[model samples]
Target: MSFADLGLSDELLQAVEAAGYTEPTPIQAQAIPPVLMMKDLIGIAQTGTGKTASFVLPMIDILAHGRRRALMPRSLILEPTRELAAQVAENFEKYGKNHDLKMALLIGGVQMGDQIKALSEGVDVLIATPGRLMDLFERGKILLTGCELLVIDEADRMLDMGFIPDIESICAKLPTNRQTMLFSATMPPPIKKLSDKFLSNPKYIEVARPATTNINIVQYKVPVTARKKREMLRHLLRTDNVSTAIVFCNRKTTVRELAKSLKQHGFGAGEIHGDMDQSSRIGELDRFKAGEINILCASDVAARGLDVKGVSHVFNFDTPWHPDDYVHRVGRTGRGGARGRAFTFVTPEDAEAVQNVEKLTGGEIPLFEFSGEQPAEAAEAVEEKPKAQRPRRARKDEGAERAEAAPRQEAKEARSEEPRKERRPRRSQPEPVDDGWNGPVPEFLHVSALV
Candidate 1:
């Protein structure tokens, strides 16, 4: 069904159409209706299934007439990461444009003075990360007592990042009568318990299985060593028909090093990680979305909540520490029903990690062979080939030495015969009998020194 059929405001529907979305996604189609009714909801869908809009669109229609007081927001959205919080805020700006609604984003790595000012003037919607929201609440810069709507996006990610306790505290502060919507890619025990404690008979809506990879993506795991990962990745980037891609590294340093290395190798690449400031991360992402860079080398946390369309590939430079992250990383591609490719680099040490990821996906990811030379076999065979050639040359040199030595023996025999003949001539009659014997023995007895 279209966004219009979901009971969205005409202004919001206009924005949706302007954004070129005619039909609602599965999560949006299912969860948007319940959310519009102000019912507590639990939306379970894989990443990149338009889950953010499922809540954001309906909330705009609900909050269009709400009265916001100073230092008090009418609605609050709790996101686990800065990227996700910023994305939700962007969604509000895009879809809630035709409607009159004030939304403020509270995330780290930004000036607090502006956030405080925005909170003091009051906002119709407050989209914030857990830590920043708590920080503002502690400073008495914002109040949630008047908040009528609460959205907890990426609840499983909250558990992964150790934000569960903070989420619980934030949930406790909000009015119990508020409408709440909880969305997660997976339903872990902690997320379930937290939902039971906070949500009031929520409508259970699941669009897909938990921890499942998108079927549109063709995924493969390559058996590669740490040293050859960069080489193999470069080969794939050059050989594959990639229009745009994300290379996911596990560490911030790896992201920096890989991006730098790719640039040095003449690839249009950029880097983003948790350690970077908010502006730098946003700049890189904007550049990537605009097609200024075809490849983005980023850490998993920084890559979260990025919704670039038509990413041709996703490369896992290093195996993730958690199996659930495998789903999230690959999900960056294959978005909005587009087909894509995902490649994961697996070393011997990463066997267990790859296995865990496969278990989560319910099968093994097919192996992808490099088109270039195989490292291990090529190294051994290349070494043996040179040694085999050396022996043949040595044998030929020995034969040449023997042939030269044979000619030297003939010269020595002639010299010895000359000495015997000279002695016989000088000794007159006494050397006459010995001369004949020496001449006959000369052919059979010969000693030669060869150098």
Candidate 2:
């Protein structure tokens, strides 16, 4: 159905049309009507199902009539991460262009003075991360008393990041009669408890099963050694005509290292992670979205809530630690009605992790082989070779052999000699005690003097 049929205001519809979204996604179709009716909502859908717009549209319409008071926002949106919060803010900007609305983004890694100023000026809409929101609330910089609507996006991620307590505190501060909406790609038990606590007779709308992957994405796993991952990634990028892509790593260090390696290999690459400053992260993302960078290496911090269009591919440079994270990583691509491809790099040790992901997705991901690569033969050859012929000895014998042979014996002895000084004994100090017979002692001394 078209966006107009969803009971959105003309201004919102016009904005949607101007933004080139004529049709509503499945989640949007189900979510918008109930939200526009001012009902509490619990929406469960997979990533890349247009869940962001499902709430963004209705929120813009609902917030259109209200005027914000100083330190009291009309609506509050709680996101899990800075990137996700920024993305939601962008959505509000894009869809609420026709309306005279102001939004303040309160997240970490930036100066809080500006956010405090924005809150003081009375923002119509406030999008903030749970931690930053709680920080401001506790500091008496923002108030939730005037908030008429609340949206908790990516509820599961918030729980995963250990923000449930903060969310609970924030909920307690808000008016109990406010409309609350919670959306998630997956609904674990904690998330359910959260919904049960916050939502009152809510409309439950689920577009798809939890932890589901997009069917349009062709998933594949390329088995390689941990040390050979970069080489294999370089090979894959060189072979595939990757127009634009996101490469997911499990750690921030790996993200930065991989981005550097990719750039050194003459690829247009950038990096984003939780460790980087907010401006740098946003700048990198802007460059990637603008097509200035062909590849972006990032941790799961960039996985959810980012709406970068025209991503032709996704590469899991490191297998996700959690099964749910796999869905978000690949879902970065295959968005906006576009077909995308995702390739995951799995090592021999990651077999169990890969199987768990497959079980979570309820299907086996197709196996892929690099062209002109001889991994099996190489492995077999290494296995067939005699242990004595191997260049590096097994780890079990490494330390023992070193200890026995003592090749660096002289150096070891020299090092030990410098530290032969023993620890000094602590000196005992005398304790003072009160004598009860001070006057008797003075008499005894006088008697001795007389003697």
Candidate 3:
């Protein structure tokens, strides 16, 4: 169905059209109606299904009629990470442009001066990470009493990042009569309990099954040794006609190292992980979205937050440790019904990890066969420096040179040293007498008696 059928405002519809989305995604179509009706909601859909827009669009219209107050926002959206919080903020700006709505973003790793200013000036929509929100709430810089609508985006991610307790705390502060919504790709028991405790008779909308991979994504497992993962990734990148891709590594160090390795091998690549500062991470993402870099090596921090369009491929350089991460990592591609491919590098040790992923997705991923010998350049890329030393003839000549100097050294030593029998022994010192003090007499006391 078209976005018009979803009951969006005319100005919002116009903005959406300008943004180039004609029809609503399944999640958007299903969740928008309930949200506009001001009902609490529990939306479960896999990644890349327009979940952000589903809530952002309706909230703009619902909040348009509300008056904002100083130190209080009319609506609030809680995200798990700074990246996801920033992404949701972008959505609000994009879809809420035509409406008269003031928005503020609250996240860590950035100065709080601007956020405080925004809150003091009053904001209509506040998108924040739980940490930053709790910080401001505790400091009395922001109040949730004026908030008429609340959204908990990426609930499972919040659980993964240990934000559930903070979320519970934030919920306790907000007015109970206000509307609440929870969205996630997966619904674990904790999330279910959270919804039951907070939401009141909310409409449940699920576009896709939990932990399911996107059907638009063509997935394949490449069996390679840990040492050759980068090589296989490089090979696939060259042969598979990759346009824009995200390469996910399980560790932040691997993300940095892999990005550097790819750049050294003449690929336009950038790195983003939790270790990076917020500005640096945003800069890398901006570069990637602007096409200055075609490949982004990232940890799971970017798996859920990135919403760049036309991403043709996703390469899992390391199998995700958590099975849930596998869904989000590959979901970086095949976004918005676009056709995409996902290649996961599976080592012998990753058999169990890959098995868990398959089990979660409920299907066996076909093993991708290498057509021929490994790529020559790829192999060279990961090759260790040669261990061979200088030639044997040079070593032999050096040994002869040492042998010639040995006679001179022995003659010098004979001249410099006295014969062992003529050498005198070192003198032994006498022990001090115990004269009541049990030690040597003090020199100061031996000053001939200052008398």
Candidate 4:
């Protein structure tokens, strides 16, 4: 069904049309209706299924009629990361343009003066990370008592980041009678408990199974040695006809190194991770979205709730440590019903981690062979690569030593062929045998000298 069938207002529909989204995604079609009715909702859908818009669209309309108060927001959205929070705020600006609504983004890694000033003037929507929100609340810069609507986006990620306690505290401060909605790709027990404690008779919507990867994405696990991961990645990026992609690394250091490697190889690549400040992270994302960079090397910070359009590929430079992250990392591609490809480089040591990912997704990932490399005789032996040879410097050093030893060996052989002599000569020597002197004895040893 079209978005019109979902009961959105005309002005919002016009804005959506201008944004070039004519049809609503499955989650959007299902969840928007309940959200418009002001019901507590538990939306379970995989990443990149239009879940952000599902709530953002309806909330704009629901909040349009409400009056905002100073130091108190009419609606609140809690995101797990600064990137996700900023993304939601962008959505509001895009979809809420026709309507007169004010939104403020609250996140760490930046000055809070502007945020405090915005709160003072009052805001219709407050998109914040839990930490920054709690900080402001303690400082008395913002109040939750006036919040009429609440949304916990990516609740599982919040759990992973240890934000559940902060969320509980935030909920305690908000009015209990307000509308509450929780959205996630998976429904873990903690998220369920949070929903039960907070939401009242929430409508449950599941577009797909928990921890399931998107069907539109073609997935494969590449068996490569740890040292050759960069080689394999470069080979794929050149041969696969990638338009835009995000390469996910497990560590911030890896993200930095990989992006630098890609740039050195003449690829338009940028890096983002938790270590970067908010402005730098946003700048990188903006560059990626503006097509200035085709590849984004990122940590798990960008894995969840980041919406970049037309990403044709995702390369997992390192297998995700958390199985659930595998879903979101690949979810960056195949967004909005577009076909995409994802490849995960699995080293021998990553067997357990890859297995956990497969177990969570309920199926084994197919093995991918390099374009020109010969397939192994046995698939199970894919990880058993030949040992790497010694480095060039070590080999060169050994060659130099061998060349230097050749002259010494020849000199020693020449000396061995010659007659051997005593290391030192005696001070005086008697000539041949028993008193028969073949050579003169020393004068000092004579008996006449003694007399």
RMSD of 1: 16.9
lDDT of each: 0.88, 0.87, 0.90, 0.91
> Which residue pairs in model 3 clash with each other?
none
Clashes of 3: 0
> What tens-digit string does per-residue lDDT give for candidate 3 at 381-402?
3344488897776346878889
Specify the poorest-scoring 10-residue window by lDDT in model 1: 424-433
Tens digit of lDDT per residue, candidate 4, span 11-129?
Answer: 99999999999999999999999999999999999999999999999999999897889998999999999989988999999999999999999999999999999999999999999
Q: What tens digits encode model 1's per-residue C-alpha lDDT throughout 267-337?
A: 99998899999999899999999999999998888555788899999999999989999999999999999
Question: What does the lDDT read for residue 243 in candidate 1?
Answer: 93
- Candidate 3 lDDT score relative to the true structure: 0.90
Q: How much does candidate 3 score in TM-score? A: 0.83
Model 4 poorest 10 in a row by lDDT? 372-381
* Model 4 vs. true fold: TM: 0.84
For all predictions, the C-alpha RMSD in Å is: 16.9, 10.5, 8.0, 12.3
Clashes of 2: 0
- All candidates' TM-scores? 0.83, 0.83, 0.83, 0.84
What is the RMSD, in Å, between candidate 3 and the native fold over all Cα?
Answer: 8.0
